[model samples]
Structure formats: C-alpha cells, structure tokens
Target: MLRRWREEDKEPFAVLNADPVVMEHFPATLSREESDALAERVEVAFDERGFGLWAVEADGEFIGFTGLSVPRFTAHFTPCVEIGWRLARSAWGRGYATEAARASLEDGFGRVGLTEVVSFTAVPNVRSQAVMRRLGMTHDPAEDFDHPVLSQGHSLRRHVLYRIRRRK
Candidate 1:
C-alpha cells in the first residue's frame, strides 16, 4: 500500500538511495542531507497539493516510493506531470514498480485530473522501460532527450520519454 512519508521512513529511504545498483540510473547517489531534504520536499508537496511521492509499504514493511510529480527540469519536454517510482534493489524483479505506477497513473487521471501522465528513464534502463511498457505506456522516440541535469558525456544523459493518456 501507499501512504504519506513519515519522519521514521528516512533511514530505510536513505538505504534505498544509497544502494549503488538502485542509484545506477540516477546521476549519483544522494547524500544523507540531500535525501532528507528530498523527503521533506515530498512531504511538503503532499501537504500543499494533496499528492506527491508516497511511501510504499507491504504488510507494514517499507518497500519504496511511488507517486506523481511535476517535472521541473528544463528538457525537450518541460512542465509535464510524471508518474514515477523507485524501489530497493531487493525489490527488483518484482512487479512492484508496475503495480504502484499503475495506481499512480490512475490517481493522476482519475483524481488529479491529468489528461496524460508521462514517465522517462535513461535509454539504458531497460528494466524501467519494460515496466513502462507493461503499464501500457507508449514511447515517443522523437521526444527522447539528453537529460539537462547531467553532463554531455554522462552515461545516463540520454533518456526516452513514454506517455499514456487517460482513456475517455
């Protein structure tokens, strides 16, 4: 299940952030301070907007996070609401990302009233791309972009954008 993040979740969340494999697609692993700040911002976004990255748990154990957030980075496609999730390395190979992301997409279209929800990952992140496909998202290769946050030569600099629109 998914719920708002709490202060107690920091340690587990930090562990998820610290894993080298888990942080592979990301530019770098987040520092403790950065993780805490991110959690705080997620919390504040939930409070202010009624939605943000939610702590995902199963049978009372922390799993990871999944939710909707507006992509703020300047990109080939900017100012789009995106559905996203990240799980621990132990949680890999499971359907958790797809499950949680499907729910987030439902919330985006049904409750949040978004016409379309987009998701993106580094071109090399086949695992995440597979999950996007399983979620019924279609990729627009023409929209692929070099991530602005990373340097030109960064391995994860190029990313592909996928989107699924709410059916009428």
Candidate 2:
C-alpha cells in the first residue's frame, strides 16, 4: 500500500538507500543522514505540491516508496511529473513497484491532472527500465540525455528517458 511517510520508516529507508545493490545505478549509496534528509524532503514536497513519493508498506511494514515528483533540473523533461520507486532488496521481485506506480499514475492524471509523466535512470539500470516498460512507458533512444546532476565523465551520467501519457 502507498501511504504517507512515518517517522519509523526513516531507519529502514536509510538501510535501503545504503545497500550497494540498490545504489548501483546512482552515484553512491546515501549515508543515513542523507537518507533521512531525503525523507524529510519527500514530506515537504507532498505538503507543497499535494503529490510526492508515497511510502510503500507491505504486510503492514514499511518496504520503501513509490510515487510522483517534479524533476528538479533543467532538461527537455523538466517541469514534468516523474513516476519512481525504490524498495528494500527483500521487497524486490514482488511487483510492488509496478502496482504502486500504476496508482501514482492514476493520481497524477486523474487527480493532479497531469498530461504526461516521465521516468529515467542511468543507462545501465535495466531493472528500472524494465519496470518502466512494464508500466507501458515508451522510450526513444533520441530522448536519452546526460543527467545534469552527474558530472560530465561520471559513469552513470548518461540516462534513458521513458514517458507515458494519460489517455484521453
């Protein structure tokens, strides 16, 4: 289930962020302080935009998070809502990301009234690309770009962008 963040979720979320496997696609694993700060930012985003990453719970336990947020950098896709997810390794392969992402898309299009949502990850992060595909998001190689947040020579700088539009 996707829901609001809880204070108890911070520890597990930090653990999830610190997992090397989980952080492989990005620059590096987040330290506990960084992870906690991210959680705080997510909470603030929801308060400001009325939509942000929702904490994912399974069997009544906080597993991770999935939801929508506006990308912060400048790009052709900037100013767009993006669907994203991150879960504990134990929670992997459970279809929770897809399920929660579908609900997020519903909220984005139905409630938030967004026309499109986009998701992106490093070129090597096929796992997330697969999730995007499973959600029926389309990718065009021509749309790929270097992630602005990553330094020019960073290995994960190049990323693939996927997009899905709300059906009329």
Q: Which candidate comes out best when scored by TM-score?
A: 2
lDDT to native, each model: 0.88, 0.94
Q: Which pairs of residues collide in model 2?
A: none
Tell me the TM-score of each prediction against the true structure: 0.96, 0.98
In model 1, the worst 10-residue window by lDDT is 70-79
lDDT of 2 at 130: 94
Top lDDT model: 2
Task: Report each candidate's C-alpha RMSD, comma-separated, in the order given.
Answer: 1.0, 0.8
How well is each residue in 57-163 modelled by candidate 2, as lDDT tens digits?
99999999999988889997788889999999999998999999999999999999999999999999998999999999999999999999999899999999999
* Model 1 lDDT, residue 18, Cα: 86
Q: How close is candidate 1 to the true structure, as a TM-score?
A: 0.96
